[model samples]
Target chain A: MTSILETENSDNQTQKEITLIENILKKTGPSYTKYILGIGSVLTACLTIWLGLFITPKDEHLGNTVRLLYVHPPVAWAALYLAFGTTTLASLLWLWPKTRSYFWDKIAGASAEIGVLYLALTLVTGSIWGRTTWGVWWTWDARLTLTAVLLVLYIAYLAIRQLDGSDKTKANRNAITALFAAIDVPIVHFSVLWWNTLHQTASVLTPGLHLTVPLSMGLTMGLGFLCTTLIWGWMMKVRYDIELLKVVDSEIELQRAIMQRRNEP
Target chain B: MTTNERLLKRRKLRIVIVLAILLVIFGALIYEGLTNSIEYFETASQAVANRQTLGTSDFRIEGNVIGSTIKRKNEETLFSISSGKTVVPVISNGSPPQLFQPGIPVVLVGHFAKGNGPGGTSLLFLSSQIMVKHTNQYIAAHPNRVKIVKN
Candidate 1:
């Protein structure tokens, strides 16, 4: 009778542990770091707007709408190249047998969360530019289409990471999912050159291609790039910090459950 | 082998299988992009060479707008595009875009106009859309002037 009673208690304890583990990832509040990032992001955004409007020169052809040049390219660069690249590298590091680290999984998740925001901005700014320049708001053209696909793919990555699983299972699954979705980056980059599309070919590239931006325009674009990059870093740090907190929370909960079981004399 | 050893081996095998699949998928994507990717439209002269195929199916042809040839008849904007060697006459039913101008490189998307004049040749392109591609700097043809076109 005592053996049966002990077995039932053991089973109930295991069930409770699983439930607590699942519930540990509840909503979290902002910290001082999040506040700093939020303030810095807003300031940078304001500076970018000032640079674009007051300082930049009207394009020789596109006129004032040319100001979009600052926002569109920089946002797209951050999303598609910088944020996405970081996520890919983190996933790769986690997957590598020699370099596997739980920290990489958290980095991948945080960068990807930030990447979704930048990706949405990329589409919005690109659409605005297209509406003004291409005479159409959206088209099924290759470059635009491929970029839209990339946005959807990364959103899927975030969704997969949210699926309920054990910590190890989730980590393994998220790493593989991230590595798979990164395949679209090359396609988005080369879409302009590969396909005849309404979108113009890239103005900047190596091997004889030169950017002929006037001083004012160049300065604004440069400012926009720097500001967006700083903002991106700030956001990433905040996100990674929150992820670390969640991990700590989970560990504390597990420790508490163990102690409770020991005290149950 | 111990259960822990077997589990580790299985995890490694899963990683290898997943990576192999990803490699194959990416290889296919690159191959597809190379073989069947859309071509940036050919020059008007280039397309003119394959008029039989190009004229029937909707294709894109590009050239510089010829200034003297621009004619705005009521709602229609008619113009000719040139690439030094061959000039393709284009008639666009839709109104020209705001930045549309002479000497600018433009790509016309539409069908070839069938003609009975001169050795059964086609004279004009029936354009559904006109797009301009140029250098990064927008050098307004007449930068100093402000012509508020009311339509």
Candidate 2:
């Protein structure tokens, strides 16, 4: 009798464990990695702020406005290069027949959304820095112009991704749009080198092809990139999971409604 | 051709046409950007010669600051910049940059608007901003220790 009772107890415990795992799979609550990323980002951001504002010396030319350097360039790199680059790669993967999957679509869409957010931040911070250093809020210069255009292109790409149609239709439309928008990446990068504009050329990329920032400034910028990347990556993963779950939940509801209609008197 | 193959061919053709249109638009934007650039500023002599053609359009003018021509008035800095043999009067708002000094090349960005003077007649470059032109090379000096390399 005790052996049979122990078996029953073990079966009940296994049932409880299954339910817990199911809840985690459903993503009804925050997960461990989210907490890790959140805490890491917050801590690193505080350190970068301290280093940028306190430890770095004032630039010879820009004075205190030089502090904008630590925040602006790293965010721009994350938005303009890393985020967009990933979107492009994911879009390409989705387009190719052999490797086509919703996984790539989810990544491309998530990265584009996060890219827009960071791109907008880059523009705002760049404008503030411009107003102080160049005595104007904006100029129709090459670098600024292309960056603005890139922001618009990706934003429109995002809007196209949201059209409520068949999954295949929306995926094809988004993939094609993304493939074309990726062309602007090289243009925005080369704009500074090719054009005459009020905005200064890149300083971190020294003429000697070396990074020439002061030690503290470099450290601050490195920290800034790490924190922003971690946070943005977490945001993208959360968003993608939610989107996939929404589709699955909607499908379940559709099947339930169909069954109810068939059983109607 | 079969119905399905014909349809596929038409879709391919449509894709090609759309891509062509996008290409033209992208090309135009890049071309326009190249024409209107950071160095779009004309010299003062060129500004004067082509003032009629440049009516109402804001542009930049590059010139050397004429000696002793920088004057401080309320909320404005009045200066004269010379390019070639011609001199243009400039009235710009905002404090000049740290590197701002007489005899250095500076680009003034603004429109050529009517000036207010005793006669209230001629036009001047009403600049909202000024920039000191420098080279791409960055060289920092300190007593820590250094070796200068020849290029």
Candidate 3:
């Protein structure tokens, strides 16, 4: 009788364990969104590499150096997207402070950081490609000049955030600066067309299309954009959580200080 | 409102005004670029063939120098570049690369000039800058070649 009871208890425990596991999986299912993002990113990165290195025809003039266009143009586009996104979000936050103003501030900070990375990559890749084709690594051409200004403005946006002020005030100030800096995007984009400059005109797509690139190339680039946005969004979410925790801790400390002072009196 | 609060509001208003001005400037630039802009890339042969079509238009041209035709008279260097069957005379006022030998690829940036001469009409060459194209294999073969060769 004892043995039969023990076996029944063991079976009951196993069934309970299985149910618990199923519940845990259900709860975490939505949070696994990053995995889907990761898969998409990997697929796009592979496609980009394949199309850029293999599918595109060698230029009659630039030869194999034309491949750099795929990488450089996308980076520049991503930077523009970052700047625009940050400015729009910041503006919305300021205009409607009742709705999660701190959240938008964190997003603006994240976008600016990502924009800096892409902007730097664009400059480096563009210079290298220019050196190969244009004979000069750097030129004071209108497009290049304006882009440099844009980079400086965004860098200043981050610097301003780091300087002393209350979180609310700092967010407002940085948002204003970001909105102003975003003006440089269209200016930089159009400078080549407006001025007699050495920099090439903007391509229909990124870096302008040299004839019609293979459909696979476009697909690959689309993938890259999607992946980058997903990864960036995930990172931003993580950072925002940390910031909120810090804010809560500070508030707790402030309240504790007030209570101690009252007790002493 | 308190004095400090009023001052902050004024500062924010100033920022809004500045941003509006910047937006106007950016809009103007876009309009300008859309109305006036031309981009071209060509080989030396194509540039020679379509000289009249590309008159005064800024373009990039690439070709290899004909081995026995490079000449120097003071600051000016003269050479014939061949891309397939097309040959073009390149007249550059700038210093030529030391490794700029025959059969090596070079890109020139400038416009073709039309001149009336003994040949009825001749193409006058003008290049502001020159770039030498070296293959990865060529560069890898002689890692210290660029260091030793001065242009």
Candidate 4:
């Protein structure tokens, strides 16, 4: 009887040790990937600031207000990146059975949220700059109109994702809808070009080099893109982990229920 | 219908409404862009050089006050804005802005009607309001004295 009790105590201690180890492993496993991405994001952001502030020359026409273009264009691009990223991820999840749809669905959700944030920033900054340069706070520019449309669409995307239950069917339905809504992006870009509006044409890259922009401006834009991407990626990972933990907790509850039933019998 | 189906239908309806609203906004914007005249912001010097084309048309004129050209005609006031090349006469029945001086940027909104010249009454000036540009330091020092007055 004494030996049996001692063995039982030891077994309990061993089980506790194993559970602690499992928890630690789970917590630490994603840290390395997240840290690398985080560091890269910081470095890119620093590079963007350096290029925008120091490298770009003041414009002959717009003067200091030209600085806004550096910040504004990249934000617009990052928003576009988010929209595209989410749609692509959603498509992949829907197509591939092997891929866990929930994981990418959460990522899509995160990207949409961040995309809206940057899009809002882009609009506000662009409007302020427009006021100073064009003597008006707002204009009926093609590019501006398209941007507004994109913003509303993605905001709808976010709202739809949040409204329903988190079951697999619900997630799949929302992901599919998001994927379909992405069709607007190309249409927006194309319509802006076709229509004559106050918004200027794309500056950073075009088919033929008509205007020679300073190298600093390009670097600044590139840096801004990298920083926003890294931040978005990190946020998606954190959210994904939280969802996984919730699933694990539910599974543990189910195991406890089975154990209780067996003991009663 | 199930609650879920009803909710989904409502969401779809909302999306359609939003899209329609956006379309109307887009249409209005296109119309405004096409109809509104495009004008460039310029100082008095540039305005004077292009006075021929600028004649008898609504424009935004920027210049410094010519000290001698200022005169009071009863309830009406007259002044000449000099860009160094030509002096553009301005007739204002309204009170002058606080910062109206011989050497500052003052934008006048009106058309150039018959006065200063074939060059007479160079600009048939009609301004409803005036804004005096001051530095942040200047504004802080004399906050009450530097208000923008609308005529």
Error of 3 at B119 (Å): 27
How does each model score on TM-score?
Answer: 0.75, 0.72, 0.58, 0.57
| TM-score: model 4 vs. ground truth | 0.57
Instruction: Summing lDDT over every window of 10 consecutive residues in candidate 1 chain A, give the lowest-scoring window.
Output: A21-30
Backbone clashes in model 1, listed as residue pairs: A60-B138, A60-B140, A61-B138
Q: B7-52 in candidate 4: lDDT tens per residue?
A: 8888877766765775676566556544431332345667666667
Give the deviation of candidate 2 from the true structure as CA RMSD: 9.9
Q: Select the stronger candidate by TM-score from 2 and 3.
A: 2
Model 3 segments more than 4 A misplaced: A1-30, A54-57, A96-100, A206-214, A252-265, B1-90, B93-128, B131-151
| Candidate 1, superposed: residue stretches over 4 Å from native | A1-40, A205-209, A250-265, B1-37, B116-121, B138-151
Give the Å shift of residue B76 in candidate 3. 6.3
lDDT of 3 by residue, B101-143 (tens): 7777776777676566322335656776676654322111233
The 10-residue segment of model 2 chain A with minimum total lDDT is A203-212
Clashes in model 3: which pairs?
A: A203-A208
Model 3 chain A weakest 10-residue run by lDDT: A204-213
The C-alpha lDDT values of all candidates are 0.75, 0.76, 0.65, 0.63
Residue pairs that clash (backbone atoms under 3 angstroms), model 4: B113-B124, B115-B120, B115-B121, B116-B119, B116-B120, B116-B121, B116-B122, B117-B120
| lDDT string, candidate 1, B1-151, tens digits | 9996888677766655655664565555445444434554778887777776554567678888998899988878888999868998888988766778878788777877666643344868888887766444443224466763322
